[model samples]
Target: MSTEVISQIDVDRTRGDFHYPEQHTFDAGTGLSHATIDYISDVKNEPDWIREFRHKALDVFLSKPMPTNWASKDLENIVFENIRYYLANAQRPTRSWDEVPDDVKRTFERLGIPEQERKFLAGVEAQFDSEAVYSNMKKALGDEGVIFVGSTDGLRDHPEIFKKWFGRVIPTGDNKFSALNSAVFSGGSFIYVPPGVKVKHPLQAYFRINAENFGQFERTLIIADEGSEVMYMEGCTAPKFETATLHSAVVELVALKGAKIQYVTVQNWSANVFNLVTKRAVAHEEAEVKWIDCNIGSRLTMKYPGVILKGRKARGEVISIALANNGQHQDTGAKMIHAADETTSNVISKSISIGQGRATYRGQVHIPKHLKGCKNNTECDALLINSTSRTDTYPAITVRGLGNSVQHEASVSQVSAEQIFYMQQRGLTEAQAMSLSVNGFVNDLVREFPMEYSVELKRLIDLEMEGSVG
Candidate 1:
């Protein structure tokens, strides 16, 4: 929603098309149980509190039921006992690229991470399977009291800062998947910017899933101290496996007084992957938190990035783009809770459904009677590319506060057959004509994406159209 643009997405369509042989030194065997919990805690040498926390979360996961809504029926297909909870090849992440294992380095090389790190990013972490193979930050940032590393390292090394806000924004009982992620979480990132420090370049992480019937649960936490600012971008990918793969991640962000945090996600999972994630942020007085998200490929995706405006004049925003292909369902949206006076929130979402795909936008905004001068604006737009494709929008906005105001707008349209035929008559193929039409439909939102990623998104949409229309 903000004009602060992120850098080019290093990984794209070809990023996870190939996978190397699996050679994990550590693998928590299939199934979930207390033994699995013990194994994970033992392997990480976690503190007793963390171990206890995991046990509590697992109990919550078991006690809770899968969502019963129509949008969640597909979730029943996931066999929890059949999924491997964790797998990793390394104990500690390497800071230098030369120190990284050849196989791990090769995996990152294919994603263009090294080049991107050198060109645009201030720091980078490349997570493979359940652990980070490489994690590094520029020295200038470290000198300026910035802490950037894997969540594991964050928990063990900087407990003072990490423990303060960890799991505070989004609790374990937020949902079943969240509880599940909290129980078996690994990798992801932890970033802390000291007061008044503004990171000049964005930090980035790439999560790659390389095993079949395996689940990757990465946990991320970011805290910007008073008057500080930071932007983080993450990309996820998994090879196309015949058996299903599960990716469930949890992200929590905290922005202190007058601070700012921008989070960007580019997800491109394979067709056999289920991408379910929970992300939320807390914005303190005069602080701001924004989520820039894009979803492309997955069998099913259910994610809603939310923010709680906890202090006066706080702001929250989300700008999202989701494209669903054949046999895929994209269920995505945002949530905003205004708890203080004069808070503001905005959401702009655009989605495209191709072939027999389905896309749904579900959002929520709440302002209690105690608040005053709170405002919210939400817009959801969808484009369908085929007769059988489908789209839906659900917005739940409650404005009970004195002088509070809310605005919501939603629209759905289909590709014009006449326009496609006319473009075809001008010598363009069906896919080309379809690409032009789809681009025309989403260009406004694409312009809001980062420069190179905007181009990459356009290309990805064209590729999807080719598969559906050609």
Candidate 2:
């Protein structure tokens, strides 16, 4: 491998797609078994209780079968036995960037993580492969009694808080992927906001998959105490590889009384990656929870960020944007469950399919018969770029109450030759016109994203449209 300087993350060949030589010191070889689970737990030096938890979760994972019914037949391709469960160069995360391995540090530097942390983020966690290379929280936040650290540290240092909320939002047995993540999870964020304290800036995490034939399972949990507020953002990327890669993560959020929590994710995976993720939140009395998700590249991705409105006057919202180009499938949506009277939930989803790619939206909203004064709204829109592109939507909503109400809407549209020609006539090239039109279709939703991610979305769209116009 060359140590030559790479200028930028491009689209077709090297779109944020480059890798360094592997120098791993810990690897739980290629297979899924009891030995693998024990190896992971022993390496982490976890307590006996946690080791038992992983074993039980492994049983659940083995009991459940692949989800080929709804996740497309592609689920059959994931050979769990061939995936290396754990790979890391260090036993624990370093608090200083200077302490990170040179290659790992360069990876973050190239992705602009350090600069972003200095500019806006209140804290940043950089995870490589299966472990965090660097984790740091702003001194100001620590002074305010806010706990921001990797999940491993959370369990070891703040057991009282970590044990109280971990897996409460999304249980290990909730699904097969969640169970898998529980059994072999590693580096992810764990945050606890003290009551009545609001973090002024966002906390961010960057997950990079730098190895081949590997599985990266990270678990994250966040709890916002009474009247507190927080916002978290995550970005993911992987280098293209000939072998398939797997990334399964479980994320849970808890917004206590009158608190607010916002979670955002932008996934730009390689085409050889299978991105299966499960994320959900719980909102208590007068609390609010929101999920902002963007999916750009993957061979197949299935994720639905849900919220359980468990208290009166609670609110939940999910706004998602997904793009599938060439050989990719973006299966994404939201779930909202109104368990209390006066609760409210809303969902807005938009997807774009280009080339032979496919995008699907799956939404579920439930307001039980006992719930009164609850309201739910859902809207899904999809765009098809070329004749070969594909999109699908499946929404299931159940409402039972006189005072409660629910509204639903869905639309699918394609970029007509007239629309592209209209732009091309204005001195823009064909590819440029197509890019503009695609961006226009989703500009409304893009505005909901923070400025930096919005710019990244546009750049990804432009790159995908290049040479795609026939």
Candidate 3:
């Protein structure tokens, strides 16, 4: 395709409407204390053991100081006492949208989750504030040995499976945010596919932040048994508030022997949100795992989706795209660790910065010397819409063993006036021309998304580009 077409493809066609929810009252108030943690546990009616785990995690969260040397400096300004730890919109997940509280149902309806779920998804869960308001699974998927529900429901109904893998991939003490998520996390998806089963349609979850001064810490877990396959998608949005809100989440995935798993996230939180999330997966013998991550609209985002090749011949791939607007900073990347022989991994990352926004990529690819026949490929590209926008690339590679192959490439450039002029000459508006160029920049990665999602993503990007023109 021509450059014009390529760029146009990057621009979304959907004129995205900004729909903000009316704020509500939900508070546990003031810092990481025993009483606050207990209040959260009691609100959820969680079992004693799980509550104990939360208290332990809360201790860890308090003991660890914020790491100042990391991706962004915004962490230092976050006030722990200013965030509401929990809010329950519903006592339990519901199978019907009508069964959800009218207010919460209106929230998801405005966000398009219900319509999208009915048209294309196999399962859908909608979370309002810190709890899932509605969750439903198609009968076909239930008959085919697929389980999809909120993490809370999983803990109550599938205790054996949930207990075995809850903290296996990402322990509570793995990092400060992980600890925080473990302590107060709520309203995330839980998925499992029995061996040899395949979920043909995607399972989706939507997260909405409807309260002011609230923190949304959601923990998600997915397991694909041997020879099984599944794909999951997540969408996030929040009301625009003057004060910054916190959204720290942990997501873990396990792809067992001969299984495949794909996890995709399309984050469009309001610009007042701090999106600090930890996501990682383990690929066992001959297993495959992929992360398709898209980031946009957050005031600051520091996320890195990683994978571990634990068993021989496992494969991992990360495809990421980030779009940063004025007053926004997107610092995102990926990590790949090769622990066994014959493991292979790939990373493709793209970013776009407009107005005064800045985007950064920090990544790692590690292959221990003891591992043989391991290979990795990494590519990162950044596009700046103007001179004021900034982009940075940082990649660390450690190769220990012999016979390992690794390749890395990176490029950064501002949009070309010549290209814009050429596109305008072809009958497109300046904004449309810019949109087309941005779309083309990440066309390949957009193709990896489910058709419905790709279409929506493209439209969102286009709407973002509307007023971005000088």
Candidate 4:
């Protein structure tokens, strides 16, 4: 119940400044219209059915009104007509990195995509602006029947498999942003693991936005066949622009019977970008799906990764962390829908707000009356670093089935003077003390991240904490 808050915190101003010159082979120009949709479909040479789907989704996006109550009033500022829907430097993805355009390759090089792939990633895909410039998978995994490529490539090479579960998990009309993404979506990963195959290493994709007054919409689909296992990770960053930028992506995951799929995302958009995304998964009988999400460095972000337990004995989990600095709002949480017997779901969310930033958690858990032996647990924690910082939690749970159990817990705490004083007495600078305290508060969750990401997260936190305290 302690409500004390600090006055101010130091913020790093140059963490996301890497930008490359815009080099596009094709551009759809600004605004959203039927002609725009037609231009996009024509550029990609999409099939008639796919083109029709895009037209339908565009109508849905236009007909639906903006959400009134779910997000902050800042949503009113988004000018759809001012955003360039698509930009691409390459028409087709290249299997060799050398074939990638020089400017695009330089951007990824600055982001360390090639280095990461050389060190540990089993496959790597890099998207610049609106289309993937480079995509490559380890030959050994491909020999094992693993399909890792850009979505466009997936549609072109393996339509039979791609069409089977592309929109099955999350329909195009799920939400306004989803519908919009469907209309002008461009580059994202498409992954498929064969039955009984286990990918020994994780696959990764990196998304970069390099255009001004532009919007990046990527559509991703992942399918793990029965008795298969796979892990996919995605990282996104955008250059700083004076005008507003938009990034809205849709990701769908399907884990078949006895399959396991783990999806991880680290989003570090520039402070001028609005990052709104939809990610969901479907777990079949005895299947398992997990989402590890980290959000930081955006003007405003609203994301809620969710899972649907569609078959008996399925399990789903979501672990999330968010950091909101000045001029930022992180509204994030998770959803679990239990439609089968003996299913389980868990959610753990942690957030930190600094300066005038705000963080909110909105979650939902549902168990129908006919489902039996269902279980759910949700925990949300928030930390305040400035007097003007704010945090909120809203959790809704519904259970009507016999032998069903649900638990929810939330807490908001501010940095205490006593802890800072104690650390200062030990010869640490006040800023260092405050940083250490904040790090300790989320240490447990930070350890859950992969080593490289964990190191980077700590560095970001330390930078944000420098000169925060007198």
Q: Estimate each model's TM-score.
A: 0.96, 0.97, 0.94, 0.95
What TM-score does candidate 1 get on C-alpha atoms? Answer: 0.96
Q: Please report, as a residue range, the 10-residue window in candidate 1 with the lowest summed lDDT.
A: 1-10
**How well does model 2 score by local distance difference test?**
0.91
Question: By TM-score, how accurate is candidate 3?
Answer: 0.94
lDDT of 2 by residue, 147-263 (tens): 988888888888888888888888888889999999999989999999999998999999999999999999999999999999999999999999899999999999999999999
Model 2 scores a TM of 0.97
In the range 100-167, model 4's lDDT, one tens digit per residue, is 87877777887779999999899999988899988999999999999999888888888899888877
Off by over 4 Å in 4: 1-15, 467-470
Better of 1 and 4 by lDDT: 1
lDDT of 3: 0.88
lDDT, candidate 1, 192-277, per-residue tens: 99999999899999999988999999999999999999999898878898999999999999999999998988888999999999
lDDT of 3 by residue, 280-356 (tens): 99999999999999998788999989999999999999999999999999999999999899999999999999999
Taken over the whole model, the C-alpha lDDT of each candidate is: 0.91, 0.91, 0.88, 0.88
Q: Worst 10-residue stretch by lDDT in candidate 4?
A: 2-11
Instruction: Select the stronger candidate by TM-score from 3 and 4.
Output: 4
